[model samples]
Target: MSTYLTILGYNSAIPTVNASPTAQFLDMEERAFLIDCGEGTQVQLRKAKVRFSKINHIFISHLHGDHCFGLPGLIASFRLLGRDTALNVYGPKGIKEMMETIFRLTETHKGFEVIYHELKSKSSEKIYEDSRIEVFTIPLDHRIYCNGYLFREKPKERHLNMKEISKYPEIQTCDYHHIKSGRDFELSDGYVLKNSILTTDPTDPISYAFCSDTRYWEEVIPLIENVDVLYHESTFLHDLKEMADHTGHTTALEAARIARKANVGKLILGHFSNRYSDLSVFTDEAREVFPNTFLPKALEAVKIG
Candidate 1:
């Protein structure tokens, strides 16, 4: 299945009245993942027409209110919805304490389970893996500990070439599974048929990287290189780059530079400072360096790769 990304919110802190904060929903290989649950994210999810029960995994970037304030409310809502399945949440080391405190103070109870995976690693590491997909952490530079996630689809099985297989009368329908798995076939006469002759290459896999609330760091370039799509925070304009550096945030131009250096297929600029009235200015600046740069549209489902 194809990969889809829905941007739920893409704004900075202190002024959420104008727009929503950082939040996103990713559907990769038919798996649902929530990235950074800011305040009012559940409302955004409903507006996006996403089923809350489908989200089994959540990845929080940092401890900042703009990135994690909505998590507790969402979990509470899940309990109210009578969810019985376990939920997995990934975030900074202190996240568990913070979440549990709120749940305890309010005396919250749920029939379902919420498993927390707190991370303290300063280097990239694999976080989740399955038969069809693998997720890795992209260590980021921010005021507090932060991490970006890389979601990638695993390699697929080769496709069978029916015309070539037809030539071998000894081949039965039952043998198609082995042939598709890149195994060679041997006939009753001891003749061998190469797997390559019976099957063709599968479709290329898709990959997506999410880097938000980070400074202009080049270390992430290698990790996210050649990704089909990248969502990087651009909180300020190039002219105010000094302020961005002080706040550990990236400028629109710097974000484009990273995207160009990484050779990514597409670059999505987000986390706009509320000061900017015209969002096009960001695109104007970034597109100068990376022509494929785009501004984020809230609640729009975009296909990656």
Candidate 2:
């Protein structure tokens, strides 16, 4: 039941005194997922007090240096820390070769295992499916081979009402599945118990999307519409709108526009450019278009609820 998102880094292209590059940690239940390992991501994780050992998966949005430059260091650190768990890395093609070369040159032998899942940059697909959640790829409009990730919680079965079910002594215990499925229970005396009177609807599953270092692409609207939380890259403010578009980055206002169009519950704007000394402009500009917008600070944890 413990689910939260921690911002490891929020700067773009460069590191500042108060922020690093792009990185985030998604914690759900007993596992954690790392999103975009920028420079010094491992250090940020330590400062945030995140249990890095629990991270079994890493998702890279693109091959951009600001987005994934710290991956090699993190992998090395994992080995130095004596990790024995297998780590799965999901990203666009060439990532495997990139990591392989880094390891080959440094003669770094991992104590565990590393699996690379090359994602298609052109299409959307169900990349990972598990009992608790499903992860899908979201094609993004970026200069390099890139894609986003969408996390959706799986549906859960209904909770049985033990008190009400205990009253029906004649009802067979073998038919519990049927009773949980909303079927009425029949007794030996021709009495019946209504399912609606005993059971209630389960909690609705929540979803979150991560899109980094991309331009304003409307194609993502259908896939991420009405998501519980959306973390979009806002590398520049409106003052540098033309520069942002030319560099294949988004402005704060543009990010907010996408969240508004998608009707997401909350919008988290990150990947800020280092030219700006203050971040108030980013928040104010995004809030102009979408009121439920927030600017994440480095190592700050944001809950979707």
The true-versus-predicted C-alpha distance at residue 95 of model 2, in Å, is: 0.5
lDDT by residue (194-302, candidate 1, tens digit) is: 9999999998889999997999999999999999999999999999999999999999999999999999999999999989989999999999999999999988899
Reference-based TM-score of each model:
0.97, 0.93
Instruction: Give the lowest summed-lDDT range of ten residues in model 2.
Output: 196-205
- Model 2 per-residue lDDT tens digits across residues 177-260: 786677887677777778875566657777889998788888888989999999998988988889988988889999999999
Off by over 4 Å in 1: 15-18
lDDT at 299 for candidate 1? 86
Q: Which residue segments of model 2 deviate by more than 4 Å?
A: 170-194
What local lDDT score does residue 259 receive in model 1, on the 0 to 100 scale?
Answer: 98
Candidate 1: C-alpha lDDT: 0.94
